[model samples]
Target chain A: MRLTYVFIAATMLLVHLSASGQSQEIPSVPLKALTGKHFDTVQFNERENPVILSFWATWCGPCLKELDAINDVYADWQEETGVELYAISTDDSRGIKRVKPLVNGKGWEFEVLLDENQDFQRKMNVVAMPTVLVVYKGKIIYQHTSYVPGSENKLYEKILEYSK
Target chain B: MVKKTGLLFLGLTLISNLSNAQISGSLESTGQRYVDDNKIQLDGEDAEHRYRSNSYLKLDYITGSWSFGVQGESYLPLSLLNYNPELKGVDIGTVYARYSNKKLGLDVTAGHFYEQFGSGLILRSWEDRQLGINNAILGGRVEYAPADALTFTFLGGRQRVGLGFDLSKGTLYGANIEAGLSDILAISTVDISFGLSYVGRYEDYEHRYLNGNNAHLVNSYSGRLSVSKGGFYSEIEYVHKGKDLLMNMGAPLIDGNKKAGNAFLLDLGYARKGLGVNASLRRMENMRFYSQHDLDGNVFNRGVVNYVPALTKQYDYALQNIYVYQAQPQYQTTPKIAAGEIGGQLDLYYKFKKNSALGGKYGTQVALNTSYWGGLDIEGDPETGMYTTKALGFGDKYYNDMAVEVRKKWSKNWSSVFMYLNQHYNRGYIEGKGGMVNATTATAETTYKFGKSQSIRMEGQHQWVKDNFKNWAAATVEYGLDQHWSFYVHDSYNYGLDKIHYYNLGASFSKNSSRVALSYGRQRGGLLCVGGVCRMVTEAAGFTLYVSTSF
Candidate 1:
């Protein structure tokens, strides 16, 4: 029995090591250079300003609300703390046509990127819509899933704290 | 030997550039154990165990203006992945190559890709892993944006079939155009957006059951408007589509005839300080949204939607969801089928704070929510055969719900919440495929936290009704050790609902990155309704284990 226990413990330790190894394997790719007319990437490490990368879909109600709330004060935030907000739309081709119109309809003035294939979503470990990630110098400082009415304000405060 | 040598050379090149590339993957597996009691079908084999597993690998290589990647997935137990056994070992995943430059954007995927058109009424290529749904298109896509607010896409491909099933011999072509009118118009407070799309498909079927054309066409249009100032915001969306509709009322009907449907959704909300209020109304007609034209023998291919209003009250209680409203396409015809037809739902939510001395150690927050859903009778009824011009106020079938929730935090590490719900469900209206009649239910739950890393949740729910299997009580206890490790146990007792109906207990353990759960309990078989569509799940004793993660 004791030997069996030892064997199990050893196997578990090996699994843990392998899992952690993958995290370390993340390549050091620069974000600023991911530029194309239809897509753009921002490096959290390269920017002195705090960064907000939000993953959303046009059909997701909570995601729309979160973006709308931020749009209301996005200009003010940009003026106050030089923050760069990047809204990534996970709208597949069927709904892709509405992204620009919806963004314009909301009067939102933020950088936008398209993850039509969910490539970035998978890389970022997004399980649900309206997932917000606050990054500073390429490191994820804070992350939150789902959104309530006033959650955007809390996120702004975190951004300010981190940027400072 | 030459091909192997070339692969070796490519592998060597990958290793040389390994320092600049990123590779990651994830694996998720689920297992189910079903125990059949001879209650429904006595004198037959009544127990089985099933297991399902799905995994994916993603690798990305980045260099300056270009990035390349591929994602591959495999599913087991053909049916679990919604695959027909006729086609074996045919994994329905994707592989792709992409290149982007300042002036051009190009994407070529040989395997599968999910696409959608505005609001997904006419087209929506998506995947819901939990539901084993993946509607990817195996094709190539290209996008061009000449201006900041305007974009366009051209795509051609074939839709994904079941896991391990080869793609059907069909081809689909589509295009989308989106523009922001606000950029050109002087709209300060009002934001307006519009989208237009067209999809054409060609099917090579051995047996053309529906229309002899062997070709399908769909046109979709969508628009949205929003106006916000101060703490008030209002937004509305409208979508319309024209395409072939498939109906399965028992006997399948392939309606190649042109059908049109539309939906309108409006939301208005206000919040300031600790107070919040929101109200919403939605009306939809003939909106059985699907991409395929000839979807025969597909159990879930019915396009009819269950209409439920987005009410402030949440029906999270298990009993409330048991007999919830589901959309029925067969009985509830859209305006296109019957003149002046309409269906809509309404919801309202409000929150309040308590500061009285009786509130004790901590202040309290309370919320109330209520919602109602019904259909409009516009034209002739099968029963009355009267074509009165006046519109019917509301259909006899409806769903009404009211709920209240309270929360309080005692110190930094402790918090608790209490909730109660009351619901009235119309079976005939909600469940299109008839079964039982109308029913009512009530439920309550509470949760408490011990610390940041440790917490416990408890729930008690009960329902009183006149139906044969109506009365029920349930309890659930859950403990969390950190965000990664947690365990939960729940049981429900249905007294005298049926001779075989008894109690069920289930437990689950999960880590942040992985999970394994086993449940052995008696599930009450009933109509699970959403939006107005209902699916019947059999009552059985079973255990299920599900695991998933990403690297």
Candidate 2:
């Protein structure tokens, strides 16, 4: 039974590889700001520099750690690479109320958006938390999942490489 | 099966010829190999089958205004411990086709899809693999937004019950409208928004109960209002559920055992650059809505139709999670007759400026949170299922938590965090066993960075309790070799009572959009909760492998 699934999965991968070339465009989903306003995700494409999307939640430990690590050096990264980071909170109603205070309390400078129903996360094929993706020219250039302690440094490297 | 595969292949081949099409997917697999140990051992089916694995493969394609996706799940040999038994073997979990036009502000979907209306008080259809919950609706939905400030959604479907496209007997219908009044009024000072939702569950239970008084359809309606001005924001929501027959242990009872449910929730907050304060209060009375009427209050959380998570601070760390709180939104007639729950929580976050007294070299971050919950004060009889609840009152205390945390960066390479928590848990009412427990926990953690990209973090924690698992001590050490590799070891010991040590050591490798982790550990026997929903698992020891990748 397992072998059957493996064969199907391998077949699907082959199809995917055959059809892949151009960088995938960001889905035009509605992103809700903390101040209760909705905007189209395609707006990120208008920026000249690269844009980073970090999917996170309040209950996720590694997500917070990754966000905190990036928050510490966010100003420097922006100054050097002219990149903007958007920390998208995938917290449902269970922890939606905490997003505002937690973001403000930690004094993070990145723009924060709410994916209250996880529509944006699902549309992006993000299965796990702390998934970071760097977008250049409205196309996803680089992406990574599950952050370690020093993963932010690697992400910054990607940002710098793409910003040029 | 062969025909279906061929059709899917044909469809993909036809679509892949398009020059502008895109393909994306994600895969996740978790396998466990149980081994017998002297201190801890697996039991029942888990022990009999030494190897168990669960895997999911999802593929999605997009071109122009059309999109299609399918998810396949496999639980070969067996699923993980505590997963729903109905999910067995390899099968197509969900499939959907959608047509979305941004210019027309219209979206339509057919087949399995997930949706939530306003806080999910009235309706929520989603999938949580860890909880073995995939209640996506299997039907049609249409969403249209006439303007930027207003949107409307209508959906009707049967809830997915299990794998192999097993659907519920009942049908679910929902309609929602959300509007931003500020946008229409052109008011720039404050933002005002409101939403209204309606959800109905139609299940034919007339033949079984023989009670003509009970209706075949159960309806729920919710209204919400939000207004935020400057740094202050507030929101209020209310829901009223139509009367329906109450079930006792998965069986419908006659003799006017029907009851109406309602819920009220409020949130108020003020936030600025370096400080934020928020408070929430909620009251629910018999608000459990199930797609199938008889499946109410099921242990596996199957057939649940709404989302009512416990509005409490979700803490991180091992010791802090032992005394977790689960929302009480169902009628209980076991030890005592109870309606639902009423409670509130408060949170405050503040950051100290750099070079200040509280802030050393880097800024200091402080967070304080507290919450209290109790049963509703109801005057009723369990025989007839009729009750009168006080408009505002606390019947019996259920849970209380108070916690404070402080984080400080000593230098460029060192940072530390300290936390303390106090909890008062009424185990008898919440868990149906054990007495009231009063416990306090304290933890301290520090991280140091060295070399180019190497870092080490150590955490120490201890919990003290007078009753119900007396004392516990836990410690963890994690080392990050570079950007892609990390290793950690954790040990949690219950010294006072069971004297059992739950130890786990693991290493993880992560690259772009992929991660793999391997661990060996003694599993803890308790309620494993995610997003406030919990499942029970027996004590066992095993080697676990997890692999996930996404394109």
Candidate 3:
């Protein structure tokens, strides 16, 4: 009976280790670290703010609409719950030039990041554009693919639910 | 003596555990048999076997902030060239190293990466498995952001060639900076942002074939802007390039001309409540947006893309797609041309309330989309000019496509959708330089669902041609068992000048984290178009299997 107990405990430990291995926590590297820029880190662990990460390209029509819809209400959300939205452009060097002009012209006020090499996209396992991931407390809580009308509202609700 | 025995037992146990970490992989093979009854070409039966098998081993070990993992994949006798049995060999697909720190807000990646710039006009490095297109960069990249409104990235690498075809080791480099100025430029009803980027490439070419060993520099600069207020939004982009623009006329061409080109695009849209509308226009001149000056065919050239033209008609029916519009890069060089041609597209959608009798119990959604696209001559000569500056009317020139769709839900678990399309395709405009027009096509499709997991989709298509194949028809039926599994059978019959029937049947299975699909089909000779470029795929009867997994 004693030997069986030891075997059971050992099996449980092994199972726990394997499960943890598959569920890797989302990396919290500073945006500068990924871009090869030097900057001071601003950690936001205490506030537990919900983070919206969107992968898009300038050439995708659906992506443009999705971002425009969110930009319409990004300010109100910030005032209410301090949510941070990161709009990552997967534009290559050729299209990279349009990123600034297009973003500035559209009047979007969210955080912008350039994944010129798609390193972040590959890590997050993104296969298509207009992919959105919602993170809470540095862990991915929800993810949605593609976009249609009124989807932004549903995303806003998810953010509000998690923030509270 | 007891301590030695204990150590030996421990050593044996470790060895057994290591052996249990199995190194296993998978193999997928396909074979095709083609039969042709043609008078012009030798006709009979030809059989070929094409197989692609990939194997990799993953080992995981973690220590502190560092974790290590490696994956290796090889294609034995790369299946892409299987149609031509003469080429056969093993090729490496990918290998990489990645590291991330949870505490330092740092993630570093060195090795190969796949990336893209906005819409890929100026720069896009990506891969499409079905098309066998992989443009991953062999280089290093780092990203960092410390503020809510600012982000920066610096990247440098070499463009990817095909497997075992990385000879012309040209250098590609670029950097991007984006800033969100909403707080700095405050407006209650508006938000604004800006970005700047530059990309340059160096290539060494021995034009010995063209008779010179000249090195050229390919540079591109792009700028974009967007504005939205209430229900209206607009976006504009401008791209400029230096001399020796690498343009892919979809065929072989010389590269050593001091030619420069520019392109501008505008998209305007409006959406409110149950209605939406959008319009777009683009004009380009001498723009050949290629990363390498010496390359013949690149989808994204610095000047303008000729194959993947923007569609006013996104034909979903198979027949309509057969004769789709393609871009013409040669039109940019007309000596008599004045202003570059301009093209535009429009889309609209509306919804009806459910209480209405026509909408039934669950309300109906109706959408009407129509688009007309044509080229302008600018100042080109009538006889020798590449393009004329004539305004594209309902049936004037270039291409015109119109489509309408109606969708409705009958009950809690039932819904249906119907669509119809009409198109006019000009072979001359679509084929570019010395290409001819083949025919015009019309098509329709319908889909019905029973409950959430079971559904059937059907499509019908037809083409009416003045010449060439004359007419064609196709139909397909699809059934879905659940979210993870779907089965479909389809057949396309040509019944005009020559009678030929092509049939295909396939099934796809999926479970949590993995998917496997198998299909057996006969493909008739035809043009397949994506975006705006078109390619002629051979006629064949074959079997295919695809598998994918994620963790």
lDDT per residue as tens, model 1, B1-551: 22332343245244434564443444555555555555532123222214444544333444544455444354433333222333222232555555555444333334455565554544556655544445667778776666545667778887666543345455677788766566557555545555666665555543344456433455555665655555566667776655434333322234422345666666666544445555666555555544344453244432211122232232455666665654332223322223222343333322232356534454455556566666645454444322332333554445666666565555534555566666666564444444344455544444444543465667777777677456777777766554434566666667646544445554444333344556665666665433222345555555566654443
Full ranking by DockQ = 2, 1, 3
Question: What would the TM-scores of all predictions be?
Answer: 0.70, 0.97, 0.69
- Which number leads on lDDT? 2
- lDDT per residue as tens, model 2, B213-328: 65689889999999999989999999999997766666666564778999999999999999999999999998888998767787778888999999998888899988888999
DockQ for candidate 1, C-alpha atoms: 0.09
Clashing pairs in 2: none
Which has the higher DockQ value, candidate number 1 or candidate number 3? 1
Question: What tens-digit string does per-residue lDDT give for candidate 3 at B1-551?
Answer: 22332333244334434543211111223323333334212133222333443322222333345443333333443443222222234333343455655444344556665544444555666544333445666677664544545656567777656443342356777666566565345554754555566667777766533356343666777776656666676767777755553233432234333455566677777765556666777665555444455444443222121122454444545666666665433334422233334566676666665588775665566656655555554544344333334333222256666767675556543445566666666665455443334454554554455653466666676766666567888888877665456788988788887677777898876542345678887666656544344455556556666654333
Model 2 per-residue lDDT tens digits across residues A1-164: 54564566457664565346436788889879998998889888888999999999999978987888889999999999899999999998989999999999898999999998888898888888889998889788888887766788888888878776
Angstrom error of the Cα, residue B16, model 1: value is 8.5
Q: Which portions of model 2 miss their true places by more than 4 Å?
A: A1-22, B2-14, B17-19, B206-209, B254-256
Superposed Cα deviation of residue A61, candidate 3 (Å): 16
DockQ of 3: 0.07
TM-score of 1: 0.70
iRMS, all models: 11.5, 2.7, 13.2
